[model samples]
Target: MTVDRDSLTELRDLARAFAAERDWGPFHTPKNLAMALTVEAAELAEHYQWLPTGADHELDERKREGIRHELADVLLYLIQLADQSGVDLRAAALEKMELNRLKYPADQVRGDARKYTEY
Candidate 1:
């Protein structure tokens, strides 16, 4: 299947097919997927761990490529986790964004970094 960068559904389908092909569904329990997702996210964060503030702005091509691959790993595991848990990943993201808008209203939280409770 064609994997379009814009399509979360396609990514989720691909991840499902990949696990099915490997008979890995049994191993992809929600807990396992969540742990794996966290590991991958840490790996992604590792790329920037030692960088000075704003150093990411100067990432060389090799560093950028490494970051891209790590990001993909994090995303794939997230999609798999959402799939195994019967969540529509895209819809959840949209829903979370709406919640964020309510919690951090633009007029009140504009230019602020504090939590909603702090305001």
Candidate 2:
């Protein structure tokens, strides 16, 4: 569903309950959760690696569905990790975007694909 803080809080509580039932919270430290996020992201990327470049829309329907599910898995784990780590993920993401905007101003990057240093 939506990925707002309220929704993330709900998802985190659910994850807490699920982990508590199996006593798995101890294994979900910030480091491990970060690692899990990376692993899951890689798995999601693997789904499209074999497809022709720029043909993402032409993939098999089932493959597209699978990719969507994997993307959700990555997002869920990210939400859970941010929750457990006390990180305001939305704010952090926004702050990064702001920094990127300064680094690559739209006027310079509107049609230029050069690296930030090239500008």
The lDDT of each candidate is: 0.88, 0.85
Alpha-carbon TM-score of each model against the true structure: 0.89, 0.82
Candidate 1 whole-model C-alpha lDDT, 0 to 1: 0.88
| Model 2 alpha-carbon drift over 4 Å, by segment | 1-5, 54-56
Model 1 C-alpha lDDT per residue in residues 1-119, reported as the tens digit of each score: 96456578888879889989999999999999999999999888877877885276768888889889989999999998898889988889999999999999899989999989998
| Best model per lDDT | 1
RMSD of every prediction? 3.0, 3.6
Q: In candidate 2, which residue pairs get closer than 3 Å at backbone N, Cα or C atoms, i.e. clash?
A: none
lDDT (Cα, 0-100) at 58 in candidate 1: 64
Best by TM-score: 1
- Write down the TM-score for model 2: 0.82
Model 2, span 60-117: residue lDDT tens: 8888888899888898889889988788877888999999999998987998999899
